[model samples]
Target: MILRRKENLSKVEQKHEKLKTSNMKWTTILLFLCFMGITMASAQQKTFKGTWLYEQGEKNGTIQLDLYQKSVENEFDMDGALCFGTFAFSDGSYYSIEEVEVEGNKASLQQVLDTEMGNFKMQMTYNSADQSIELSTNGANGLPDKLLLRKSDIQNQETSAESPIINEVDNETSSPINWTSIIGAVILIIAMAGYSLFIINKKNEFDQVYTTEYFSATRRSNGKSPQSSSEEDTQVTGLLDKLQHELTTFQNHTSGASYLVVLKKKQHKKCAGYLRQAIEIASTNPEILHDLQQYAHILANSQKRLFDGSYSVMIAAGIATLLVGYLMSDLLIVILFAGAIAVYYLASFAPQYLILNKVANSSHTSTGFLGTLANIVGNAKVITYIFDTQDTIDTITGDNIYRYDDYSQVQASVFIVILAYLVTGIGIMYIACWRFFRNFIMH
Candidate 1:
């Protein structure tokens, strides 16, 4: 009886141990899932990509925080990580974070900070959507206070490029026009001319109505001799002639007109409106209606092509500037040149799209080509200046202020050289386009 009781007690103890192990396994799985969920949530938010500042109420005065991401490049593991930069801290202390972990919208930062008092282990939490940050210490020889930070969008400090020393390099030597770009530009112009000629030839030869074939088929179907249909055919031919003459006049007025002729604020829109009005008064003949449609299409296409070609030259000029600067080892010039090109393209394309929208509806809008170009050039200058001098800050408020010398004459000369490059490209392309359209008009 004693042996039997001892065996039963040992069996119960083994069973309890097995149950505890099973429970622990499940708990581990659940914890892992929770951790993965948090990681996924943080990724979805992309919580660290801008500037944050300490609020006015915080003891730290005029502290700025900027966070950005850098990618870790490894053959096996490719991922981006968050990095933080602390600027203008009150205590003149700075942090160099070693690790960052994100949980949902909040991110935790671990950093070793050296302050006036002493070195401390600091912890930070960032809330992305709220654009706020909370800071504390680990309670072991750390910061004595907690603080909050908010995003400062308006008075944001821009990082500026280091000023380049302007030595006595000749303008031509500093920014030599790349012969490769010139060759490329020449080839592009030739291609544009070839394509335009082909299109114009195709347009000239296109017989949308097949009037002769239709007339012949009609004669065969009716089995009518020349005498029988002569009277009716004469009247019909006269009417067709009159309609054809009218359409020719309309085409000449619209697509065949010169740039000087259509220098209005809404050139395409006005032309399209006139075409629509002509459509309403057009002949009922199927052939005449088809011709009208073809002419209208030609006008729209010609205008669109001219604008597209001009804008493309502007972009090409920008590309040329970039290439030349790169080859010359002028990094600052390259950046400014790239910025100007970007601004120029955006200014050209954006308004043109709006104008197209207006033209499509045969409505008028207030936009002109020269005016648009002027605005683009002006805006590009301002943007390029900001980009070149990012670290230099100037504001109406007295709190945060930094100043640098105004744009000098050398910069202006550099810009002129850039502009000249653009204009040369435009001139080449414009000549090609003009010749193509002249031939089209003659046809």
Candidate 2:
């Protein structure tokens, strides 16, 4: 018995270890992505990249230099940018920008002239800030190897600058997803997710046993009785098969699947009840009656709570689902996380959502979903809608003071309340993950 318990403990430990790895890996990646975003947002293009009109031989020609293709989003170490831009002639002909390099305040641009475009001017179809516009031709030749666009050129020329760059397909992967420093957002998101986890732990702070004793229906839901002896025999045999299957699976479940066994045990009890009812009025052989009684007796007295389910897994998963779904700017990461969640639930066994929710949400039995539901809604409002808001707080507080030409004056600022909510939510997450295996994983 001790050896068996040791094996069970080992399996449980292994399971927990995997969960730990998954949680840590996910959190780390998200933090990294958030930091990358911040670095990129902060390293943003200097005040020098834009259109420059140069007068060469009395011809007024303008050049546009876009630096978005080569992003310094990685570590702000980017010096060379392979950007695409254009210079239009009065006749609607244009030069496509090949590469651009920024030094101090001067941006040096290069364009490999493609004569085959036949004066195909880039119109609404070219959006460099959103997508890279690459010009292609059988043979390329024309514009000078170097054209400089100075930052102080708007004095005599019209200039449109500060356009976001595009995805460049080259030696490196076109779309680079590094980290986040758009950090305020990422930290806020992580903090909110953490708090959700903490609150889930708080709300689910109870244990309750579940059983099929409440089932009122014993006969099959078809509402039709077996018309003949053979039909009755078939029904009896089927029920016996189902009961045996459920019982066998219940008994054979691993230590890791003890919670799933709870589900299976409930199923066995339900099967036993139905099997007994089926044999009640039927012309049952003595062997059948004896078999039904035995199984029912066994199921009636099965031991429980020998093991436990990780109560916070579902809550963690729910928080993870939201975190990955909304926090991750990368679509692939979101899809991967979402797919894992879907596949796990598709099995309909481990981490069973229904059972998990019953355990996690025992706090709201009296108040109904409204209790838990309102709590979750309030948390969301606090995390998202409450902070840095312009007017919702005022509307809620009834602070519509009539003054100063507009209601914004009355609305004023609600940032303090939002900041407090943000800090509280994040703090909860931090506390939930604190050591001693306290909140989320100890079970």
lDDT of 1 by residue, 1-443 (tens): 45346546755975776575456444433443443354354335544434456644344544333222222111112242222444345655444333444444444554433333244445557765676767665653434556676766754353221112221112222112222233333443344333343333333111234344443443344444312244544444454344334332222235674221222224444554555444323233455545555555544443432223355455555666655565557655454445444333322322222334345455444444344545455554322222344443545443344434555554665576567655644333333334333322211
Q: Residue 425 error for model 2, in Å?
A: 23
Give the range where candidate 1 is weakest over 10 consecutive residues by summed lDDT. Answer: 160-169
* Weakest ten-residue segment in model 2 by summed lDDT: 203-212
lDDT of each: 0.42, 0.39
TM-score of each: 0.33, 0.26
Model 1 ranges off by over 4 Å: 1-62, 68-84, 87-89, 96-131, 135-147, 151-154, 157-414, 417-443
TM-score quality measure for candidate 2? 0.26
Candidate 2 regions with alpha-carbon error over 4 angstroms: 1-49, 53-60, 67-84, 88-145, 152-443
Model 2 C-alpha lDDT per residue in residues 297-356, reported as the tens digit of each score = 445333211212222333445455455445434554444344333322222222232344
Relative to the true structure, candidate 2 has a C-alpha RMSD (angstroms) of 19.5
Backbone clash numbers for all candidates listed: 2, 15
